[model samples]
Target: MKLDIIDLNLSYGSTKVLNGLNMQAKPEITALIGPNATGKSTLLKCVAGILKPTGHILLDGEEILDKRNKELREMISYLPQEIPDLTTLTVMEVVLLGRVNSLSWKVSEEEIDQAYGVLEDLGLDDLAPRPMTELSGGQQQMIYVAQSLVRNPSLLLMDEPTNNLDMQKQLEMFELIKGVTAEKEITTLMVLHDINLASRYADQIVVLRDGKVFCSGPAEEVINEDIIQEVYGVKSTVHFHQDGFPQIVPLCSVRCLPWQKRKDQGLAHQGSVDFGQQN
Candidate 1:
């Protein structure tokens, strides 16, 4: 499947969030990375139909905005940044909720099996009978991820999916997501803050700046010292491992150029300072 976002625009009352943003992704994992307030989450929301935008969102060359609610739900699954704490439910019950649309008067055996199957795949089967309140935050996040997967969505939208996890859990979650999404050929768009993690795992990377795509391509093509400085305003070194993935070692934030500081003070300079060598 291919996702094509064309001339997309969104706003919050008067303040614009996304402005004529265009992007394309194939059936693979694509990581959206940018500084704060760049509308990464808003873009995902528009695609998931949680928030409406003013342009065409096409999946496999067909427009999806006009589709019915059921069709839209089948096509996409979204996990927001903050998942509400519903400790009263069991893990099995929570995951079964993903199939609420397909359920009738009684929950079927096949649905229960499907929910268990997904939890097992994520190594959370042991927690199925446990109350959600008894598990750690990372464990609950995994349960929610399994719930999203049980919907069998063609496209998955995750905003900051690794919010509360420690380093080990984050790695485990990414490995699971990569394996499952690739095996099922699902198109996933995720907003992530860790540049190194994105470089290591993402099949494609989209860099957002000022609510626009500053750069986007394969990881090696888009992630470099120059782009990092330009888009993230950070100095960094990028190196490739033997596995052929880029690894980023961030140095420090880019210091303000002399000309910019002078300009801020309402003064003009005869010669401009070279930001390239400023750091």
Candidate 2:
């Protein structure tokens, strides 16, 4: 499936969130990375049809502005940054909510099977009977991701999906998301905070700044240190792995030259003193 954003403009009350934004998303994971308040979430919300934009979005070449709520919801699934507060439902019950948009009155047997499948795929099958409020933060995140995927959408938009996940679970989540998106042939766009993971997993990366796109292209072209510093205002050293994927090492504040500050004081900074060298 293909999703197209055409000069999308969105405003809340008076402030514009997306200013003439444009993008084309396909059946691959696209990472939207930027600093805070840059409207990454706003762009995703607009594309998902949660918020009506001033311009148009095309789903499979059809204008989304003309589509109704159920029609648009069927085509796209959106996972918000914060988990929903549903205390009355079990984990599986909450996941089954993914199908509620299609239900006329009652949930179907097929929907039950689909929800269970999503839970198992997300490693949340064991938590099926637990209350929504009883799960850990990472567990809740996984369940929410499962809830979004249970719909088998044409496009999935995740807003900061790995907010509280540990390092191990984070890797697992990315692997699972990649597998699902590939197997299901669903286009995935997510607001990712981890640049390294985005570089490794996403086929496309879009950088945003001040409600506008700073730069966007393949992850290879957009993951350099220059773009990082330019978009994030922090000095970082970027290194490429053998596979040519980029990894970023954020340095100290951009204000001072630490080496120069040390040298100016004549503190006997010896020649190439490698700390804790075995030799």
Reference-based TM-score, model 1: 0.88
Alpha-carbon deviation at 215 in model 1, angstroms: 1.0
Query: How does residue 249 of candidate 2 score in lDDT?
Result: 91
Which residue runs of candidate 2 sit more than 4 Å off their true CA positions? 102-104, 255-279
Q: For each candidate, what is the lDDT?
A: 0.89, 0.86
Model 2, span 181-227: residue lDDT tens:
99989999999888889999998998998887889888779887787
lDDT of 1 by residue, 160-239 (tens): 88888889878988998898789999998999999888988899999998888989988999988999998888899999
